[model samples]
Target: MSEADYFKNMKHDRNDPNPFLAIFMDTSIPFDEEAKAIYLRDCSSKTRQFLLPLLRPLARLAIILLQIYKSVVPNALTSSKALHRVLYWGMKTFVSPSANHMILRHFYLGSEVLQFIRDNVPGVDVTMNPLKPTNLEPVKDDLFLIHDLNLYNFIINLNRELRDKGLEVKKRDRLNFGAITSTRIPIEPMPDRWTNFLDLTSAIEIFTPVYQMFLTDNDFWRATNSLQLDETVGLLASKIIGSNDRLALINNKHPMVPLTTLRAGFRLVLHGLATEQLHALLIELKHKQEHADLSWNRG
Candidate 1:
């Protein structure tokens, strides 16, 4: 089916026990084998296998340091323009053009997914007002900001709903990021055509380790179980571009989940280390390719 038609016909039942799972079971799309191959190679690389165990202690230490940093610089982790600027420069300088496109596309995709959940799921009235994507010129900083605000609002709103359901996802008492602004920034509609170098499942596999490291155990479980974001994203992805395993992996259990949360945490640390290595390699390859093109043009 065409992309536009897919979204038009997308349907979810509010009465379904798990709307995300139900949606995926009812839909099917073609798999991108090239993207799947890249994901599999990175996940199974010998370098990653060797370093997984070694990174556990370092990951623990890093988490402790992160807590210390958060205490010292309370606003550092909070959503702000300054943080966005740093991220913008980092992406422009180090990330490949294809990777940058994928990253930006993620913001748009995420916004749609969140909106879908809010509208279809009962009792999920998240106070999100994302800015329109009118122009991609200013390096799409506005789009990034909108995505961040949407995520922030979604979490805050979802937490409130969970509290009403008697499942408190314990958090810091002083963790308030203040009220969300009502003003909306204008943006253009998503382009009709864009390169798809990376699929959603691959992107999820790449970032799951980093997410596991950053989030506390309770918060992580609450996000996965209570919010069911994984299933929602998996469903959204499956409908657009099918996962190699189809909907088989789209469930309540996290792909990284192990015998215990503790073990899962350690395994994720290794995964993060491997991801870093892979990212560095990509950056280097990008630079080399650019240099080769420059030389050819000069000659």
Candidate 2:
């Protein structure tokens, strides 16, 4: 058969009746392999000049606006350290600071709550610990956590979103998280599936007093009210789509990530509890996990 005819037949026979031939699907190249190849081909610096005309207007506008902003804003704002703080505050106040990543949001929230407990709750001594990746199956997921691009993409998208909403956002260099680390609370990772409940509780039992302190402290409530984190959680729940569904070939023997990913709903709510120590956080997680209704689906 001709090359074109072979490809046409391949498309049509994707659902071939013969099990042997259909099972060989594993050998086939990815559907987007050609598109990916084309994208990489056009990514060269020489090829990139082809789009100069398309970007000229945007580049000019950005340069003009930047000059105007720099001129009008106070000279104090020009300091790299001050500017970073301003940008970071804007991101936290207006946008979801965790890039709307469900799991990361939990870590962020947990750290904040722990810090609050340490600062305001008398007699409570909550220690901040680094959450290292676990030695679990599918090491790729752990590696994905270590990569910094996710954080960078979140910041870039945040700036884009703010600009779309009429804020004149200047393009800044890749943000350094270390600059803002002092402001962030640290949190340890939760127990993995392999960890027994008794062992898990033992590690986390220190948090019980912290959680109780949150319940009793009026200052804690005041702090949360000031941050308007409840609304932030609502906004995040509405914005981030949360589901744990996937498609797989029935005959495939080896599948990646045997379990569905943590649904956004659970992650967001869990973060709320971890960060805010709101009433009945655990209850909410349990209810949603059991029912997983449309409301929970929003996260």
Candidate 3:
């Protein structure tokens, strides 16, 4: 089946006994061979497994040190050069080329799915404000601070709306972008490699394991589980999306769950903020370079 057709036919049962199986049962979209090989190698590494416990404490120390560093030099973490170097080092040391390829490809595929939903779903507001890279300096830090919470709110709100309307994208008609008129088109186009900056996938892979340490089993399961197309429009939608509601109830003396989930959620929020700052800094630098190149060519 075509990629669009494959996504169209995808389904998930929210009441499934095994959430993991529900999310990954569709193996039609295979992982890249090299990515699979690297994943297997890491999983089988005795040394890596032994060092895994050390990472949790080290990650906490790094966080404390970063806070101190940021206080000492306000712009240290936000500096374009600093951001670029960190991204370079992380990609070179931690991320594999094949993994990067797979990450970018998933992005493109995810975008296609979203576009399909926006086009087909009635009354769905998928429109987002255009990112003003040039005017981002003033609120760049603030943007990073709330990136995770903002994403959480977005997913929750969108899902709630979908539920209220009794609408779903997966249940829609088959996606047919029409027959190709040109024989020159490739069956599958490769995504461009993101060499200059850290993408979301790489950032999540690098940081989430440490963040996972703070979460409860329920919260951890929620964090790790993947969502279907109809679920929050392909984002990691879960029961924990209702955590904010639970928090409000707890504040009103009607506690539904332990306070630890709240603490764990905040840690994830901070992780998202820090990751976004790095991403935004690199993006700002990229835009500046492009502008400079254009000006130089004109001169």
The numbered model that scores best in TM-score is: 1
> 1-299 in candidate 1: lDDT tens per residue?
42233333556567754433333343242222222223333344343456444555555555455556555664343433444455444444443333344344334434544554444344444676744333344443544445544555676676688667664333222211122111221333323333322332233333333443344444343333322334434443333222224444333335344333323343432332232222222233335556777999999
Candidate 3, which segments miss by more than 4 Å at Cα? 1-38, 45-47, 64-76, 79-81, 123-125, 128-170, 173-231, 234-299
Comparing 1 and 2 on TM-score, the stronger one: 1
> How high a TM-score does candidate 1 get?
0.37
Candidate 2 structure, TM-score to reference: 0.18
**Alpha carbon lDDT at 233, candidate 3:** 35
Q: Candidate 2: where are CA atoms >4 Å away? A: 1-105, 108-209, 212-216, 223-299
What's model 3's lDDT at 122?
A: 60
lDDT of each: 0.40, 0.29, 0.36
The C-alpha RMSD in Å for every predicted model, in order, reads 18.5, 25.0, 16.5
On the 0 to 100 scale, the lDDT of residue 231 in model 2 is 35
Scored by Cα lDDT, where does model 2 land? 0.29
Higher lDDT: candidate 1 or 3?
1
Candidate 2 lDDT, 1-299, residue by residue in tens: 42223233544354555332243233322212221222222222232344434444444444344445434542322332332343233223332212212223333433332332223222323234433222212222322222223323333454454556654322222211221122222322322232212211111122222221222233222222222233332222222212111111112112222211112222223333333322123223334444655666786
